[model samples]
Target: MDIKIIIDDKNIKTLTYDSPVLLSRVIRDSGCGFSFPCSGKGVCGKCRVRVTGCVSEADEREKKLTGENSAFRLACLTKATGDCELFLPDKNITALTDGLCSRYSHSPFGEGVGAAVDIGTTTVALYLYELENEKLLSVHSFANPQGIYGADVISRIEASLGEEKEKLRALISKGLEEGIAELCDKANINKEECKTAVVTGNAAMLSILLGEDVTGLSASPFTLADYFGKTVNINGMRTYIPRAISPFVGSDITCALISGSDIMKNEKLSLLVDIGTNGEMAIKKGDEIICCSCAAGPAFEGTGIRMGAPAREGAINRVWQERGKIKYSVIGDKAADGICGSALIDSLALFLSLKMTDETGLIKNPTVFEGQPAIEIADSGVYITQKDIRSAQLAKAAIRAGIDSLLNSCGAASEDLGRLILAGGFGSFISPENAEIIGLIPPGTAKRTVAVGNAAGMGASAILLSRQALEKSEITAKNAASLELATSDFFMKSYIDNMYFTKKD
Candidate 1:
C-alpha cells in the first residue's frame, strides 16, 4: 500500500510501497524543511517526529535520549510501515530565502564602482554594486580555500600555532585572491576597475591575511597589535579593515556593526548575534554598545560531529510540524549524507524540547538502529559518541553565556531588546524559534529577530561602493569597544556555569 505523509501543512504525494525509507528521509525528499545535524546517524537527534497508526522500534540511543514515548520517534530512526500523518514543529521550518540579500542593493560607490569582500572562516563572498543607483551589479560566493586546512577558526588557529602559520596565511590569501578573480570573471570586469574594497573577518583571520603573528591573539592576556583602520593593497585592490575591539573580536564584526547602523542610531535597544564557529555579539542599549566574542567552536560548521558536513547539497537544513507528523528539507534535494551547523542547532533545540536529552547533555540509552548501518563500529573507531555532545555543549554554553554577560554588562534585560539581528551564513538556516528554544538567543528575541545574510560581506560591499561608507568604516571601528570574553572573569564564570543545557531557576 502507498503511504501518505503530510508535512508543513501540505500533503506530500504518497510513497510507493517497498521504499522502506526512514520517516526523516521521506519528509526531506518531500520538501519539508527538517534538519539532521548528525546526518541521520541518529546521533544528533534533530529529526524527531510524532507518528500515528503504527509505532517504530526505538534505538537504545533514541530511547535513552527521548525516553520511551509512544507518540515520539527520531525521524531518522522511524521507518514508514503504512499510511500516516506527521507533525513538524513550527520552530523547524526555515524559509528558503528571505530578503536578507536585498539590503545590499545600495551601491556604496557611484555608478559602476567599488567592491566588497567578506572573508569568512568557512566561506568567502564578494559583491559589486553600482554607486550611482546603489544597486548590486553582481554577487559571488565560494568555499574558502582555508577550509582545506580546517573547517573552524580554532583549527586554523591550531594549524597556525606551529611553523605552518605562514603556510596557513598564504592558503587563506590564495583563496581570497581566487575568489576575487572568480567574482571579477563573473561580473565581466577587471579587478583594477574596482576602485575600492572593504574586507571583514575575525581578528585571527584578519591577522593571518595581513601576515601578522596570530599566536598572541589565541592565548591568555589575548592582546592585539592594532585595531585601528588601515589601508592595504591586495592585488591592487585598496582595502580597509575595521579596528579590532578586542583580541578575539575582529574587524568583521565592526563591519557587521556598520551594516546595522540603524540599530545604533535608533532609541531602542538591540542585540546583534553573528553565529558562526566563533559566535560574536554586540548589544546596543540606548547610547551604549557592549560587544563580545565567544569561542563557540565549529559545531555549526560541520566539524567535530561524525556525520557533519558543510551547508552543501545533501545536508538537511530545516524541519517542521505538519498534519500531526514530522517533516524535513535537505539542500539541493540530494540524498541524506550529513547534517550542517544550522541543522545541529535545530536538532539540539528539538531534542531538548522533546525530553530526549536533558540539560546535562546526557543521552540516556544510546543504541544503534538495525537498518542504520552508519552507526556500526568501523575499523578506525566509533563515530559519534558522548564526546560530540560535550563539544556541542561547550559551543552552545559559550554563546548562551556570552549573551547573558552582554545583557548584564549593558544593564538591560532580554525584554528590553527592541530588535535582534542575526548575521551569518549559518544564521540563514536556523529557525528563530528553535534558536530561542535552545536558549541560544533570549526567549522574546526570536520575534524581534531578523536574519541579515552575510552582513559583514554586505558592509564590506557598502564600503567598497561609497567613499562615504568607507570613511564611516574607519569611524565605526575607532568608536566601537571590544570586550574580551575569554579573559573576563564574568565571561569565564558564566561559561563554566552554562556548560550544561539546564540553567538554574
Candidate 2:
C-alpha cells in the first residue's frame, strides 16, 4: 500500500506499507513535522488530518472529539487500510530564539565554529558562532519534535520508561542534528567546522537526549540519573550539557542565570521564574541562592486545554475589552484558531473584570459546548470551558504557590523583592499586569516583573563564547539549594489558598 503525506498542498512524502498502518506512525517514520500532543492516546483531538481513500472508520472516541465535522479525522485513531492520502496541518510553528544576555568578556575555548543549543521542552534554539572572533553567525529554532510524545516532562518521562524510550531519544537527536545543519546552511559554513555545541535543558530533557533511564524522575525522591556538567560526543560532535541544580530544576535555569547574572549582582533580593510545564524558580539574596520546581502542568503553554495551542499563527496572544465586548489580537493577524498562554491570562483577567467569572473561578451563565459549560471568546468557535478554567487555575496556583514558597523560604515577600524576572518564550510576551489579575503571580510583584526572553539560550551562547561563563554555571549549580515543594507544608497550604481567583494578601 502507498500512503501519501501532504502539507499545505505539497506532497511531502510517500510511504509504502504492506498491511494496515497507523497514520501517525507513517508520519513519524517519515520524519515529518506533526504534533501528537496526547502521545497518540486518541485524546486531545489535536492531531487532526485529512484523509482520502481507504481508511478505518472513526471510532466513537474520535467522533465525539471531532464532533459533527466529517472533513477531518483524528490521526491517532485513524488507520490507513490501503492507498490513502494524509494531509497534515501547517508546519510553521513560532519559537522564540532572541534573548537578553548579560555582558561578559569573551574567552572562547574553540577555534572553529561553535553552536549553543537550548533544548526546551516545547522548542529548541540553536545559536551558531564564529569562535575565533566571538561573533554570532546564525540562529535556528524549531518546535521540539518530542512534543509528539506529550507536552510535559512527566509525559516524556513516562514514554522513556516504556517501549518508546529509544524512539524518544531518536526524535530529539534528529532535531538537534537538523538544527545544526540548518544553522550551518544559514551561516554558509562547512558542517564539519562546527566543532563544539553547548546544550542546556531541564534534567529530564537532557536525560532523554543522552538515552539515560528516567525511572528516577517518575516517582518520589525524583533522583536524577545524571547531573550533567561534562562534555559528551553527540554524532561525533563534541557537545557539553550544563549542570543541573536538582532533579526537577535542570541546567536550563543554570544557563538562564548565567545569561542574566546581573539580576543576582544587585544587592536587593531577586527572583527568577521560568514559567512552563514545570515552574522552576530561584531566589537570590547576596551569595545565598535557593530554588524549587513546581508542576505547573501544560495549561500555560496551551496544552491539556480544549481549543488551546502554542503561540503560533492564528493563535490569540492578547485579549482586552472594548465597548463592553471582548477584543483579541491574533498572531500574524490570522483567524483565531486557538488561544495560547498569553491570551489565556488576558482572557481570565478580562473575565474577572467583567464579572463573567467569580472569585471562585466559576463561569457565570455559561453556554454549553459538547455538554460542558463554556465561555465563548469572540465568534470564532473558540471557547473556554469550565474544565479549562480549572486547568488554568491549577497551573496559576502552582506558580503562585511556588513564588510565595521561594519568597518565604528566603525570608522575603513579594514586596521586598527588587525584581522578579520571568524567563522563556511564554514569559517574554505575557502581560505582567494581566498575570497579577489572574492570580498567576503575586499581587505586588507584577509591578516588578521583567520578561527576559530565552535566557537559557542566552546562557548557552555565553558559554559557547566565554569559558568563564561555563565555570560560573557549574558554581551556580553546586552552591544553589534545592527546595522540595512536593514535601513542603507551606507550598501545599499556599497552593490551596491561591486556587481561588481572588487575591489573598
Residue by residue across 116-171, what tens digits does model 1's lDDT show? 77777766677776666765667776655554344567666776778767776776
Tens-digit per-residue lDDT, 1-505, candidate 2: 9999888899998999999999888888887767888888887878888899999988788888888757999888999999999988875775688888876678875678999998888888899999888889999989888887777888889989999899989999988988899999999988888989999999998999999989999999789989999999986789889999999999999999889645667689989999989999999998999999999998988888898999888888888899987888888867888999899999999999889999888999899998899998978778999999999999999999999999999888788998889999999899999899888888788888888888999999888888899999999999999999999999999999999987564
List the candidate 1 regions with Cα displacement exceeding 4 Å. Answer: 1-112, 369-386
- All candidates: TM-score: 0.73, 0.97
Give, for candidate 2, the lowest lDDT window spanning 10 residues: 258-267
Question: Candidates' lDDT values, in order?
Answer: 0.67, 0.89
Q: Identify the candidate with maximal TM-score.
A: 2
